[model samples]
Target: MKTTIEKFAGDTEGVSYELTVFRFKGTSKTAPSAYIQAALHAGELPGVVAIHALMPKLRAAEAEGRILGDITIVPAANPVGRAQYVFGELEGRFHLGTRTNFNRDFPLLDRPDKAALPPPPRNATVDVHLKRLLVGLSVGHDIVLDLHCDDEGVPYLYVPAQLWPAMQDCAAAMGVEAVILWDGESGAAFEEAAIHPWLQLPAEKAPLEGRVVTTVEFRGLADVYDRYARTDAEGIYRLLATRGVIGDAKAARPRKFSGVAAPIDRVELISMPRAGAILFHVEPGRSVRKGARLATIVHTPGEPDGSIDILAPQAGYVLTRVSKRSGRAGDDIIKLIGEARSARPKAGALED
Candidate 1:
């Protein structure tokens, strides 16, 4: 086991952030290597605690000489977002300085090599530097897991459409409730950037089945509990063992994934029609019929038509909702996994 602290200079003089990386050596030279990172959004901590719980298991495996492949972990991936707090609330999703998502704008390498990455510009912000540093550390690996969490949702995975059926085993091993498959581009998100380089190579040189890449949403943001962390840790360990990154004779065989598997276009981003306090009639993991009342917005308080009802656009499964009760007009208030392609299919990533 080894630890490295990488420092990146901040936009101002004498300001900097440290990114800690951990590495574990393997006994077999032919085994596939893996990379796991958590909290890229900074405030999302489900993956952070899960990684904390998973370390002891990896240490034990190393001690027992059961670790067969290289493993690298970054329990907290974003030191820049980790320090961003506005007024009293934690602002961790987008970089405050550049207003760019910490997970977006990653360098899409031409090939799966560090040399293929372009040099950062002299005027690049700290966020850009951080993205490049993360890509450099992960692109060379065979498996990459960028751990994150949604606002208020069940455990799920955002897998590239190219890696769907092959990555289902990983999804099943992680015990997530849903799997969303996306194709083309996702604003050059980390998952898209990680797989972009490999797809450039021929199938013989880079068999798609041998690689694993995903942005794991470990349930909602507030689900950072010991029980959930332990469960998620075990799920990840199961994947490592199943993928032959580590040897675990007693690990159970993964069953077929039975969760909702849908394309990115099938998702419905139900936005609020009017800005006001919301009263949700449905939560995540629930089923709804078309035209069912999903929520009500108190737009004009103390009036006859003071509120407006938000109904389900179609029969579907509720995937997530905004954590806040209040929202503005046109803000996405909830997400629904419709039975078919959405009436208004969306492109790119799910959110900005």
Candidate 2:
């Protein structure tokens, strides 16, 4: 077990942030390696707690000489977002200086023409530097898991389309309720950036035979309890064991999984029409039919018949909802997993 602090060039004068990485070295060089990170959006804390709970187990495995593969854990992946605050509230989803999402626009080397790859930009922002450092550490790993959480939702996973079938066991081990599969590049997200380069080559030329990468959404932001953390940690442990990264008796045993994997485009995103107080009629993991009233928005509560009902566009299960009851127009309010009904909006990224 080893710990190292990697420093990033600071955004402001006389200020710099450090990323702490925990490494558990394996004896064999041929063994698979894994990179697990949490809190890329620093406000998402379930992954942070889960990482904390996961550490003790990893330490125990190290002591027992059960570790087969190198494992790297970054409990807090974004120091810049962690320090961002407006008034008394913590703002960690996007950089305050640039308003860019913490998870999007990663530096990727996967180009159509190998020789056409652009050189690294000079005087890059702190976020770009952070992305470069994180990507540098994670590329070439056999498995990469970016732990995150939704505003208010059940446990779910966003897996690349190519990796979905291969990751069913991992999804089972993680006890996620749903798995969203995405193909093509929405944006150069961390997980996509880490795996896309290898995917660009022909099957015969690509070296991504055993690679697995996915974003594991732990749950809602408010679900930071120790019990949940422990459960999530154990799930991760089971996955590592199942992947042969660590030896465990239960590794060979069959595990039951309850989640269903669906295409990302099929997932319905219910956005707010007008800014108002929202009253939700459904919760996460509930099934609904087309035209079902999911929520009601009161644009003018004091006026008679001022409320507008939001209906489900398609039949599916409720996956998540916004944490805030009040939202502005066009805000993301709810998400549902269903058959493809309407085309996705013209957006650079998936999430708001």
Candidate 3:
């Protein structure tokens, strides 16, 4: 087990932030390697805890010489977001200075030429530097897992369309409740940026068989607990074993996963019509019929007949909901995973 700290120049003078990486070296150079990161959105702590639980097992494997390939773990991927706080509220999703999402607009390198790359600004923000450093570390790995969590939701995965059935084992190992496949350039997210170059290469020349990348959402914010973390960690270990990164003790175990996988566009975002207090009628992972009452908004709390009901537009599973009880008009209150629904925008970005 080896630890390395990568320092990135901060936005302000004399300030800096560091990313800690844990590496477990393997014997074979051609063996599959993996990069796992947690808390890119610092407020999402479930992945952080889960990674903590995963480390001990990895250490045990290291001692037993069961590790077949290199493994890298970044327990906390965003120091900037982790430190962001205003008036007692943690603002970790987007940069406060630039109002840009921390996960969006990452640098994409399709070729090895430096001339083809866009010139950096004379004074880039801290977020840009952070993105560059993070992407640089993950670019060559055979497998990349960016662990995150939704505002409030069940365990789900965001995968690229090209990696579908191949990633089913990973999804099954994680025990994810849902998988959403997307393709093309959406918003230059980290996963896309890291995997795009290889995907762009000619099929005959590219080593497509060795690459696997996906973003794992480890349920909701409030779902952070020891039991969940341990379960998630064990699932990740099983995934590693199944992938041949570790020995095949847990890998030989039968699959117990029972989740639905669908295209990203098929997952509908049910938004609120008016601002009000929300009362949810359904929980995450629950099945719902089309036109079933999903939630109710008290738009005018003191007035008679002040409530408005939000119904499911299609028959599917309730994958997630907004974390806050109060929301404004047009706010996405619920997310449904339905079959054969009209596709949303095909751009590769995730819904915020």
Candidate 2 C-alpha lDDT tens digits along 29-134: 7778889999999999999999999999999999999898999989999999999889989999898888888998887776423343455588678988888778
lDDT of 1 by residue, 140-219 (tens): 89989999999999999999898989988888889998999999999999999999999999989998998899999998
Of candidates 2 and 1, the better by TM-score: 1
Top model by TM-score, which number?
A: 1
Highest lDDT scorer: 1
Ranked by lDDT from best down, the candidates are 1, 2, 3
lDDT per residue as tens, model 3, 137-186 = 77777788999999789999888888887777788888888888887776
Candidate 2 or 1, higher lDDT: 1
- CA lDDT, every model vs. true structure: 0.93, 0.85, 0.84
**Model 2 global lDDT (CA atoms, 0 to 1):** 0.85
Per-candidate clash tally: 0, 0, 2
